[model samples]
Target: MTIRAAHFTPEVLLEAPRRSEATPNSKGSLALFSVSTYSFSEHKRQSELRVLDISRNESKLVTDSEDASNPKFLDDNLITVLESKDGATNVLIGDVNDFKKTNYTAGTIDGSVDDWKIKDVGKGKYLIAIAASTQPDGTLYNSEKAKKPVTTGRIYNSTFVRHWDTWVTANKNSIWVGTLSKDSKTSKFALGHFENKLKDSGLESPIPPFGGAGDFDITDTNLAFVAKDPKLNPAFNTKQNLYVIKLDNGSSPKKIDIPGFEGATSNPNFSPDGKKLAFLSMVQNGYEADKNQIFLLDVEQSDPPKGLFTTPDNKGTWDRSPSSITWSNDQKNLYVTAEENARVKLFSIPLAANSTNSSFPKAVFDEGSVASTTFLDSGLFISSSSLIDNSAYHLVPSSGAPKLLSSSSRSGSSFGLSRSQVSEIHFPGAKPGTTIQAWLIKPSFFDDSKKYPLAYLVHGGPQGAWEDSWSTRWNPAVFAEQGYVVVTPNPTGSTGFGQELTDAIGGEWGGLPYQDLVNGFDYVEKNLSYVDTDRAVALGASYGGYMMNWIQGNDLGRKFKALVTHDGVFSIPGQLGTEEIYFPNREFGGPFWENKDAWNKWDPAQKTENWATPHLIIHSEKDFRLTIAEGLAAFNVLQEKGVESQFLTFPDENHWVLKPENSLLWHTVVLDFINRKVGLKAYSEQSETAKALKESALSG
Candidate 1:
């Protein structure tokens, strides 16, 4: 709750979680999340969530240092996560690569609960957990802790309890449910929830989950669930219960319905010497289209309850549903993760118990439109955004270069896909022949005998595309760790060079992407001879703040210097009444009273008194899309027409910035306003001009 400001202000990025979050520590069908080496664009909402072992993949800051999500294993010698020292949350455990921690418990709880389930029973002598406690209809619930709990309850509510997943359990007193989240919050992906384990703490549904399955996944045998209570999907109401909850230790707990199995179930798994159980049902007779099918069922052949199961028929296809299903620790490789062709892939299926119509096909990894994955022997994990450099990798396969994992390396794109050693310029257009591709990053610490200090940057969906997400409150790694080189250009209405270079920057905002961002500063000063064509600096945010208001009224570049701008909108009809989702009534596909010469030739208030340059801007009134009244009317017309400019604005924070200590106070307010207007610095190398932007710059 403390925010400060000095020079050209707008700083507040402190909320450190930076990459390596892999997440899942509990729940079932194998789950654990910490693969991160740090990528960014906040893991496209935790993509496909698969890679279960890379932190103690054994030891190397595995757990105990603290901060873990839902990490569980138990049978492989225990892991369990969820810690917090003084703030008080509990369930800690150790040794799986959580090197050490014993068992502790106390409580304060009130974070967003993930999932965890154990119930081992026999030998470790039966363990038990279920998760999400706080019941009585609100704070959240689904309890059952075994030795010291007995059974606690609370089904759903608290802005829809993080989706819901317990999967399968059988000890701390019975459990199973589904849909494990598919995007920020979709709520009960499929269906199944039937509880009753009460000793006086919580839980009492007798087949609830909005009365069915919610999203579905029931294969339990702790005494119920062979399959029937299922119903929901009026396009996702999600209720379709499939019974079989028999656990009656001392009374009441029954629901064994299985008539021709009525559909739903998912990724069930067992067959590794546990006697066949394999699952994935779906079916749906055009009934809102669903196809899944892979089923097996042998559960030790006790044929009595109307025994009869065999459908046998499938190659594979799913316009949607069947996003995951694994099993191959000797179960003969099954692996699924499907959504096929239109995004989300990875197939490989082979068990041949009789071989239906065919089963020999193995595709395994796709992510075409990016998002739908898991085939990891160690490299097909997917949670994407580098739509190709717009940044966020973590791919792994041969491990050559895929772990950008994201904490805020932020890219997979507000620009292009991800991957950038940096290079590509090609330009000719407006006559005879045209090519233009323009790209650059050169400063992971570039050093051709050392020169540095550049900073072009520019990307704000002016149709957005720099082939990677370019960061800027001065970030290209805080101007390469306080030195500066940046350069990101995909100009001429960017969008990976497709669809007419993004409908030529829809509404032709600021002419030819403002000459492809001033011809990417003359193609990084004629192919980066080490940069410094005399202290360059232009930066951007939101249509690159309308090309820094069209580069101080078209003088473009003499290699002058300094200029920042975030939340920079300047005034498209005063930014259509402070934006949010309806983006200036469609970001400028029209409006401002139906196009006033494309809003006076893509207006920056038709050139703010020809901008004079030494700019800074950086706003935030929690800008959901673009607002801060166009950087407070260019800081009240650069402090009522004297010009030199400075604005800052941030504090109840927004418009991106989940906090990493306000991203190191937004790189110390754009490197202390480019070290007093384009002097560029941090250490400032005894300013001979900041010793050539600090020895070829680059450090992060």
Candidate 2:
């Protein structure tokens, strides 16, 4: 069976530019943002800087290059941006008036800068904090030479052999401070010799692979950054601690001794007065996603840091995880963004006299999911969006409705669907008095009397929720474009509902969450006449993938015509050894040996005899979180049981398909598999390009 390929073409759904990394100037009159444009034909990403005038609501292009990001306002007239050129990344300082550019890392070899801070001191002296990657000897690690070993067949002496998506290299991130000196000839500023702050202690700033500007902060006399010691167990002991280095007098960095909270500390921010430091701390060791609370430390006093406002229960739960903290000019209030009831809202908390006990976070912006926010003299400038809307900038006042400043219309319009097409649906769960929220996205060309095929997508994080936020991956609009009525539900294990609902799936991954999904499907089928339940397909990744595996083994296998599992766990006991050991152990109650019954209760490997559903198994080799072994085992079971299935593997990808070309291939394969299994052949014709792609996929 074949369908017209025009509806599923990449050009129809892939032309949106991504906007991020918004930074407002001191006066808040103008803001700079990075906009990324993708070219599917070329398979490349090009980034450009857009300067938005807050008052006028106008944007002007600043720089257009492949490596332009992290734009910061050094001063009212000076702007700094990171640019990559000739296979090296460097800091570029530009004047706002004339846009004259100057390369700060001119003499440095193959240098790269990640996060940097510029602070003005007295008498033309400036303290600059830079999170830069260089070799152990303060030189650039030549990529061409690093690819080849210095000595053939050298002995290995590294702890982290590889991480996330890249192999661990000798290039490590270090914090450096450089003084600005004006060149007499050109009247442009250049950094005078940079001093390595982390020279005495061999540690990397922002830890590696994941940390960013949130992991560090800077003041006039001191710089506080997050780093993990390589000597510790790299696998299970990835705890980042806060270390403060004095800018002057050459003092070694000192680890801040915060009593009772010794796990991971990040998002360091200094108060306006610089007397106190505010940061986020997680209490449990080895568990990265443990509940994080805001902590305040008095720089002058040696007392332990005070635990400020936390969730209502005061326990390390999943209720609140505050991030993107910003301090008010008066130092009396701190603003943060946290997940609440299926959306991320901006919240503000007052700092009391004692600093120990503070008021609960008051919701500042409650409408949409805020991704990034910046403070201005007029109001708060935020980038927010709903499930049906694309990311846009809004100016939110102290007490008024948020005004839209700029919208990402390029991608939003590319979907060819209006906001009215997507609506929220709530249904009662299997458990009494419990309500499950699901988003129903109707196809653009919909009729009330017509029945449409259903696409049920499950979100990954057992603690994750299908919030009213836009997603580039697993987009409901894409599924809707393929003539499927998409339904995404936030079940019992999902966050953003409440602590009780999220905690209900801690030890019962296959229990309440599974029932909530089934009940959700049943509700849609029974109540919604437009949904064709008999022609439904279920797809999921991570925990959702685990549920797919569970459903295939359980009685729910007969409900859906086909299933798609991406990087899902098949055997709990087998995954216990290969997967990341910390969170799974806690979520499954205990070790597999100690809690064998709990581990095997929902183990899909134990019920392979009941697996009859046709499935599409997807896995990546670098997915260290779930590992490729899980996908292989599930595929092996399906083959042995003679159930129709196909296995797709990406040798270069990680837990998520990130590369542009890889993502295109993933979507193509997934859509083709679903269409073939669900017998979707309305057009009964195929384009030559579509046939060529199908043949290529099969031949490869």
Candidate 3:
């Protein structure tokens, strides 16, 4: 059964890093970044929010709020921010020095705040707001208490929680935020345009098909604005489209339609003079339109979006999606980065007046790593650990390729035994000759003489790599901090190596590659003296879930103590026709009706009778990929056979929990479950864990 790439549980695609930050200041300068761990429990990506000094590579800790987000760097002293803990939102103003220490809570008057923002009316006066949690219509507000609040962005403290409309930026008083759009399930529009207005939980909010239907940004001609709608239902791509809105005072939005590009447009930036807008689009998907482009949109013309270079020139019609496009001071060229091979490949576009699409985009430099592009004055900024320096960068004008910038890295910080660090351990991989380079993070203050318990980490992406990234939710740090020896092996079919390694599992489901993972675990036991072979658990999401199913079907062993699958696929056949996304269809190349055996053998459902692992299934309600039913099917099978298992589904989260509060809460539950099942003392519930949570709240 062919599955659309989107439907493959998304664990692999998710492994690739995602980035977000406020717009650059007047001089195109942003030397510092306020980052937080905004991620879901289902994937293995970096998670944490902190103010990183771009120049020094230093960081100031923010509250451990899963929803710690909406940061505006107004000057250097003051910053406007939104913090949500429980179900309310709190907007605050602070000098950069004491921003972390400021009192933050939801609501404007008192008690918990519901919503907020910082508005500067261009002059000198600044306006801050605290709105009611309930929308105008009277339904519950978009918070923890709502029906299902999607953990949209930031890691607000554990108590803070917001719905899909978690973050937004606009001109202080006018409230014209050209970049963000707040849409609800009932077709409600918070940022002017909404297609499907979802029911509001708090008061009453306006339904979509909102006030600004086609475009926004109606005030400055110099500023180019375009809003792309990913459709009322993001899980399905067919409903999505792109729109370009020119921000001129009193000018209505222009819904420019690109003839061939079907998917949504992402991260559109403009030239210094605002004469041109550069953006990227996924174009078409099912067949072979993985290439994204750095299209040049003429703000002077009508629907004049020009497709530049199709990336990887050799691969089908691949496109290098230019993300975070920025113009250099000289205006002689544009500094941008394109995403390639799951990581970002940096590039440059010249502003030569006489050059065509072929001449302007001259290849200059590429890190060939998973880095998110940003800018800091003359140089470009990137957020990635893939580089040798962990947090290094490139200085555009003076650089050759890209230099590692991080001078000092606080490599030693633990959340107790719940989060640990294990470096430089190698294991045997799928085949005997292949070496599985890995890391085994153990509990803090671990007793080496004694054999400690071990929790196996199954990375989600079949093509994804197991890299070192930080997170408080389902964090490897948690296991090490909590005292368990967590094993993460980059078995065969993992990325970071190349596409050959990634495509290894493309057509093979329950074949040798899957066995390679099991073998990798065995290799760890046989090689690493630090790992306790006796205690182990099979854990993963997406395709990793597929492996877990394979293990259960084969009745591998009683060696595994517990199993966890987050947004995984249980039945390939069922997933093809049923999933919200068409990923299975695309991957497998056809419907299950045409290829029955391939569907059966490739599916973990067929081997249900041989299941044995004590499994835990986590399903994100907003996950557009492998629907919740797939997880439920696994639960039913495990339960019917009397196999020990539990299922926890987050009704308010998406494929990934992009909020801090929920992330903290999520990590808490997962760690607690693992600790309890693994025969570890539940001391964390009373001491270490509680203290960590509290500290995160106070600091974050």
Error of 3 at 452 (Å): 5.7
**Ten-residue region with minimum lDDT total, candidate 2:** 1-10
lDDT of 2 by residue, 513-595 (tens): 88988889889889899999999999999999998999999887788889999999888887654534656676777777898
Residue 512 error, candidate 3, Å: 6.6
Ranked candidates (TM-score, high to low): 2, 3, 1
Best by TM-score: 2
Q: Tell me the lDDT of model 3 at 143.
A: 44
Greater-lDDT candidate between 1 and 3: 3
The digit string of per-residue lDDT tens for model 1 on 233-253 reads 222222232222324343433
Which model scores highest in lDDT?
2
Error of 3 at 217 (Å): 8.9
Stretches > 4 Å off in candidate 1: 1-131, 134-217, 220-333, 336-349, 352-363, 366-383, 387-661, 664-700
Give the range where candidate 1 is weakest over 10 consecutive residues by summed lDDT. 1-10
Predicted structure 2, TM vs. truth:
0.90
